[model samples]
Target: MNTSPSVPGAGRRTDGSSVRIGALVPLTRPGWVEAGRHLLAGLELAVRDVNDAGGITGRPLELVVRDTAADPRRAAAAVDELAGLGVAALAGEYHSVVARAAAARADALGLPFLCSSAVLDALTEQPTGRVARLAPAQSHGWRIYADFLLGAGHRRIAVAAEPSVYWAAGARILRDHLAPRGGGVTELDMRSLDPGAVCDELADKRATALLLLVGHPEPAVSVVKAVRRDRRLAGIMIGAPAGQPEFAEWAALLGGDGTAVPFLRYLPERLGPLGARVGAALRERLAEAPSFVAYEGYDTVAVLAEVLRSHGPDRARIAGSWPQVAVEGTRGPIRFSRTPGIGVWQWAWPPVQVVDRDPAEPARFRVLHTG
Candidate 1:
């Protein structure tokens, strides 16, 4: 673990007082912990790198992290603690619901939050300069996926997954994106049907493709299994933005032909040394590859670090500096504009088929789609 010397006060605190920086990460649950570790690793590396290079304004950055467990209630409390500690800035995780809670807390406290990875579109909207996102919004991802499906000549699409608030929002965004193109949307609620019933319904659907908008791994996998039981649904290509490596295991268990996940293809891969380091460290620590959530965490930190460098450690400065920070993120450049969400920083991740599973690199599954 890299530690930085104390930060001084005011523009340039020659007094040699250190700034207390806080972060929120889910360290409790096994799944969230696994992802959190990768994010933490990335953040740690960035801190180390910055400190080694003589931190901002000759004052080193400090980090204090909390476990949010991806739970909203926990996340709210976590933010409250961080704010009370008087941190210079904050970042963490990929779940939007948690970010929403954290945003509310940050707003009440007048602190700048450099959202690490939560994509929920609402989290980005802070009446005050308290909350800002680092990645493409969740709604943006859904819209992009919907547009891609429409472009692929898939007008009729079936949606199936665990009933979650995120999925609902994603579905609405998908509908909006498809509406302009006259695409039809139908939902196959996994909660309402049994495994066998789901198979029959999906097999009978006239939809051209399947969109899995679920959150948890279990429900998403179950829906896929059901979709595959019937060979008649062979031609329908399946897609998921919240892809997991376990997805391959589920597909293999169900013997499904259609299984794919949408992910942003990072260019010059080494450009994100922080991300690469975090992923590598996580693999070594957990004995498994990091998940998408892990990548979200690393990306969030990278964006925050860039903003801090140019804008200084002030919360207001950080908020004001976003427009100036040109970040080449894991997905693409994240540039927020005057139109709230309408900006070039937005990304369109393409769907990729999970052709084969590699146990040696569980998190490094082979993607069918490439540049």
Candidate 2:
């Protein structure tokens, strides 16, 4: 098949009109599309800001977006197409499984992928220089969450989990971190249990805390409702370490029941100057308060735009440039390093916090813990 010369990847662009970065986001059903919208909001905002001042080397920095829809196979294929289209680098992916697939393909294709979100620690089987991540790995964030559970005096924990690698990995991280500290995790497989069954199991086990390791608005919402209604489980605390409560839909669906269910969030107690400014811009663009995923998206382009400015649009140069990255991001000074157990070039961490919607004012988030 003959390729079109008008495509960005075509060799015909010797004039250097623009530098393109491929964006992988889930914008449709089955994917957490609200998160994608926020992520895209941050990415688009950064690109606009970059171009407003000046694009990389006077060429407009362009974003070629493709929907991953939270599918691994689709994400891999998008990586191939984006690579073939001559994207200088890749960014965005909220789902860890999808990001893992895209990262693996980008590594093999020599494409620099700065993953915006997706906390699975084992993002790739083998380490490679091409893929770097901005989110805290599952182990790091989940361990903090486990510590929060311990701090709250909840030693016996139960996780209502689904059959997913991401879920299983999260469970493992919680277990590993909590076991040495006298905390035990009980896994209630959501596949076999309904909302009532989960409540029954929680009551039977006498678990003090029920960590939601399942997806949102489905078993998670139902389970929360069941537990909230059951008199036996009224004293039990609920948590969502995977950040299901971070989005507005969770509160919109579960309302009062969703409040106080502490979830992991990747922002500092206070936004730095840049973070505050960007947060305002993102709020304007998104027409609502932006999620951490949005800030992640902005930081991604911030880091990449700097790399492209200093290093040009070469994929290898961008990958090689990861170690030297030092950009003032929305959250804090963003840098990359090899973190223990994490395979990609990681940002070490963004500020991790256990926050929840205040039951008194569901629109407001109250910080429960931080690290």
Candidate 3:
């Protein structure tokens, strides 16, 4: 339950009044610490920008930071702490599991939670007026990725998936999409099997492409490296839906093997005007380009700031205003959809892309397909 002090200029008020927002980020989780750092960076940048632009009807916009650490219990506890701290709204979570638990707590406390990066459909499945998602659901993004593969003439695909909720949801969506198109997928459990053995199995199936639904960068990178080493699997398209700008370090680890390895991402090679400005600021501040998590963090605050400006720091009003939100976001025009079967108040289109890690320059990536 560690909390960072508010940003220097944030929450400063001439009348001694300020509005506080809660940011739930994974700061100490082993696999998620770096991701949480990137997310927090974007969020802090947005707070600065919001304050500079006359924050929330002339009141300073303050962010109260809490670390979720990839644990549901911890996330819930953090939410409770943030509520006690008197935050008017909540935003910026990375892991879906953590987001789910925090969302439940926020709902119970009647706090407005603007989810930044969690993709689990269940996060928005139940009608919780207090919660809204900025990122597309896992099913929505995976269906789009599956269509991209099919459109590229890939029919016989092998899916290597992790057992996490995130990976399972994506794998199911991809399976559903492929089954209807007369294309089939061979599903492999990535957690139990050896990477080399998995590559051998895919090679035996004569698979045209290997679609990895592994959620983390380490296993995704291992699978990619293993598949590339097998001469028999040469030229096989190795694609990962979760391994893009979020895990861009995997590209550097892949070396030459990184080339043409397609992955889904929200940020494109060329960002929109808002995105470009944020990207440049992030690069200058962090000494590297921001990841998709960074963009999500930025947009979450930007959306919340807009809601606060119109609604005047009322949590109920903020929640109610989400349905009417149609602001232009860095990724695209940000708006939530109320359609059935999708998560409640989930972003209909989050501007996703299928990009490849440039082998010549591992730090850079080129967009191959956009949706």
Candidate 4:
């Protein structure tokens, strides 16, 4: 049976037995379920591993989960709940808006927190920031994706993103990447999953290809449906790498040949011992095998464990320890840096895929042409 741990100010029981670690995640929504599950599973695995390895500072670690439902206000409320529980620190927020809100709350309470999934640039720029990101920022992803597009011989392109702050930020970075080379970029912004409206825009713009920033699978599918609605777009490519499960489904929906670029994709066997081990374990526990984000979560928690063990769980201590601990995670080598302020740019630019009727291995997608 699972049990809650005792922590400092969070009204924990008297035992003082376990060190509580809190995680703010989106668990209630259907669309974000897979991403949320993978992330939480990795954290759960890390907690279990810690206890197996004699726990942290001789005390076992207990994880307290709070469901943010991908809403900022709810995320803020979740932070309050976690902090109220006397958790030593918080970690793992997938969405940037929620993360920003949680960061604000963490700042208010002076709690040290770790955020893995929020990629929006603004989340990292909180004025009294008490947050540390273990994942790449929106700008980094945009730069890498844009660079990939440029390298892949795609000079003229169309763009669309979920009408959220994160994708908006990504669009800006993408614009920067394309403007210098040539002003041949087209922008299409979509906040709805209505396929018809988006498809019309895709045709009207004469977009040769598309880049989407929405993470949800439905929106991605909508974009493809919109594209397919116009028979003329049959040859026009649609690309979205940062968005995952959606990419796979969209490709399948498009008769298994939709184009997609993922932020991370590497066979475990090719990734070396640590990568192989993490990948193998994830396959066993998760109902669905690990995706890039899943491996990323596993890697993030592993790195966090390394940081905490080496520097202790004290927020101040762990913050200082980030500079010293570097690891080659599933996404490749990553380490924190204070200069750029977004932590570290460890992972590689995502991999691309062409949807096929069979869709190939969930792990295997057709590599799109890229530099």
Model 3 Cα lDDT, one tens digit per residue, 1-371:
47765654453332347789999999884438778888988898888888877777878888899888888898898889889888999998888878988998999899999999888888844687788888877877777788889988888999887777777777778889999997788888776788988988887899999987775566777787888889998878988787543465665566677778787887655678988888888778777777888888888888888888888887788888988887877777888868567555888878888887786776667787887
TM-score for all predictions?
A: 0.76, 0.95, 0.93, 0.82
Please list all clashing residue pairs in model 3, or write none if there are none.
none
Task: Report the poorest 10 consecutive residues by lDDT, candidate 4.
Answer: 5-14
Better of 1 and 4 by TM-score: 4
Candidate number of the best lDDT? 2
Q: Which candidate has the top score in TM-score?
A: 2
lDDT of 1 by residue, 318-361 (tens): 76676576776554466655445532223333122223343354
TM-score of 4: 0.82
Q: Which stretches of candidate 2 lie over 4 Å from their true place?
A: 1-16
Task: Give the Cα RMSD of candidate 4.
Answer: 5.1
Among all windows of 10 consecutive residues in model 3, the one with the lowest summed lDDT is 7-16
Runs of candidate 4 with Cα error greater than 4 angstroms are 1-16, 127-129, 191-194, 246-269, 327-333, 341-363, 366-371
Deviation in Å, model 4, residue 219 alpha carbon: 3.3
lDDT of 2 by residue, 149-198 (tens): 99999999999999999999999989999999999999999889999999
lDDT of 3 at 255: 69
